[model samples]
Target: MVDDLVPIFALMIPIVAILSALVVRPWLRLKERQMQASSAATAEKAAQYAAQTERLEQRVRVLERIITDRGIAVADEIDRLRDDRTTDPRPLN
Candidate 1:
């Protein structure tokens, strides 16, 4: 009886090891694929943010040029008041 049982135990060990290996291998592959997809998405988002930042910088440069062409002083108090008022706020003293 003991001799017969030893062969069966040996066969069972190999079968269990093979089954575990088969299950674990696919799980690792799926995890790796998920990580790769996430990295790709992050890269795409970063590229879009960079493009938007560049566009904003270009628009700021255009506004600076327009202000310069119009001879608007950067520190002029009267110009600041006029810009803040949608309608004339002149007071009669």
Candidate 2:
């Protein structure tokens, strides 16, 4: 009787595997989509951060140039800008 059951068990194994694949395929596809979306969002955020960093670096370079220049003219220019701001009568929107 055990020998007779061996063939039956062998046939059931493939059937069970097919049924499991049918049941799990959709779940696997959904997880793959989620991972793709997460990857895209991460890339977008990294690009935004890179752009922000570049802008900050540019500003830092400008400030360094101003500080490293050998002249009282830079101080005079900064003071003039400050005075201009106080004298401006335009209403800020």
Q: Please tell me which predicted candidate would have the highest TM-score against the true structure.
A: 2
For each candidate, give its TM-score against the true structure.
Answer: 0.57, 0.68
lDDT of 2 by residue, 1-67 (tens): 9999999999999999999899889889999999999999999999999999999999999888877
RMSD to the native, candidate 1? 5.8
Candidate 1 has its poorest 10 consecutive residues by lDDT at 70-79
What CA root-mean-square deviation does each model show from the true structure? 5.8, 4.0
Q: What TM-score, to 2 decimals, does candidate 2 have?
A: 0.68
Clashing pairs in 1: none
Best by lDDT: 2
